[model samples]
Target: MLDLLLAAEEGAHAEPTAFFLEPYQWVSVAMVVLIAVFIWKKVPGMITGGLDSKIAAIRAQLDEAKALRAEAEALRNEYQAKIAGAEQDAQAMMDNARREADAILVKAEADSSAMVERRKKMAEDKIAAAEREAIADVRATAVMAATKASRKLIAEKHDAGADKALADEVIAGL
Candidate 1:
């Protein structure tokens, strides 16, 4: 080993005797270096272009989602306003209904009072009619008794029509 090292150091070695002295190995290593350099330059641009396309696609999707969300919020606000307006209208309708019901009740009460008063007046009229009927009956009885007494007196007197007329004329002259 020492002798070989000395000979190697004397610069008398024209060729290397190691196992890795094949000429094809250098060409293969150079080819590998050239391919690596080519890949390093070209592959980065392809990768960046692919990543930029992906970022653009994602941004487009995000914009679409934002627009849809804004539309949904606007629709929700419109529905809320409609619901509020409907509730106000319903309250007004209920208030009007209550007022109408109160008016109907008042009118019914007034009509009932009027009917009661009319019934009382009719009862008083019936009583007055009954009193008039009794007075007429009494007068008819008095007229019938007077007619019977006058017929009895005329029969007891036994006077003829001519004699009665003569007596009535003399009494008138006196």
Candidate 2:
């Protein structure tokens, strides 16, 4: 120690020292002591454990988000199916309405045609009846005329004596 002091006195350019150690060497010794103390306290294990816990929490959150996304997608697919079914039902209803309308039109046409046929039949029957009535009237008028002409001819051709002879012949036959 005395020698080191003498050396320091002899040169102003001597390296500075304290307690037989240089300043740089003391700094190195302090760093080694700090590292040893950290190991003894298990600070490295605590830091790694904290990091591991944080990683596990993040993984759990990711899994939950994935589940939620899958559920949302399923709901979307279900809604899409429902919409498609609704569209199909609407189309079916429209088709049914069109078919019913067509049926109604056909029925109406058939009914109208039947009505026209009935009317035609009734008109023909009326015309036939009128013709028969006119023929009957003409025959009656001809019979009346023929009877008058026959009476005139009989009066002109036969006298009172011929009528008395005809009457006497009818009485004898009876």
Candidate 3:
């Protein structure tokens, strides 16, 4: 066992073998070959190109979103303007209605006043006609009474002697 231990120690201190025949040297060579293959294939440039294309697509999407937002804002403003115009039109219509109502009211008032005046004039004319008729009736009654009184007086005072005198005078004149 002592001799076996001495032989193992001697092997451990021995000089290195040929570079290609060592296991660690073979692993180093494989890594170098793989790195060289990757460089030759331009893998880094392809990766950068792919990343740049993705960035451009994202930027284009962002720009489209901004344009859509601007279009929406413009539409909102247009709708607001239309609403304002509609409100103004409604107010104008209301004003016109009020003016028309006032005009109608004035016309109705005038018509009513005219009707009242016409009725008053008609009443006055009727009253005047009635007064004239009453006056004429009173004058006729007064004339009848005076004629009757004068006839009664003449009948009571006239005598046969005066009648004879009146008769003689009338005959002489004739």
For model 2, residues 88-156, the per-residue Cα lDDT tens digits are: 999999999999999999999989999999999999999999999999999999999999999999989
Candidate 3 — number of clashing residue pairs?
0
Cα lDDT computed for each candidate against the true fold: 0.89, 0.96, 0.91
In model 1, pairs of residues that clash are none
Q: What lDDT tens digits, residue by residue, belong to model 1 across residues 40-153?
A: 889778889999999999999999999999999999999999999999999999999999999999999989999999999999999999999999999999999999999898
Error of 3 at 46 (Å): 0.8
TM-score of each: 0.35, 0.45, 0.38
Separately for all candidates shown, the number of backbone clashes (residues 3 or more apart, or on different chains) is 0, 0, 0
**What's model 3's lDDT at 46?**
93
**Candidate 2 residue runs with Cα over 4 Å from true position:** 1-11, 89-174
Better of 1 and 3 by TM-score: 3
Give lDDT tens digits, candidate 3, residues 93-167: 999999999999999998998999999999999999999999999999999999999999988988898899999
RMSD of 1: 33.5
Best by TM-score: 2
Looking at model 3, residue 96 earns an lDDT score of 100
Q: Which sections of candidate 1 miss by over 4 Å?
A: 1-41, 93-174
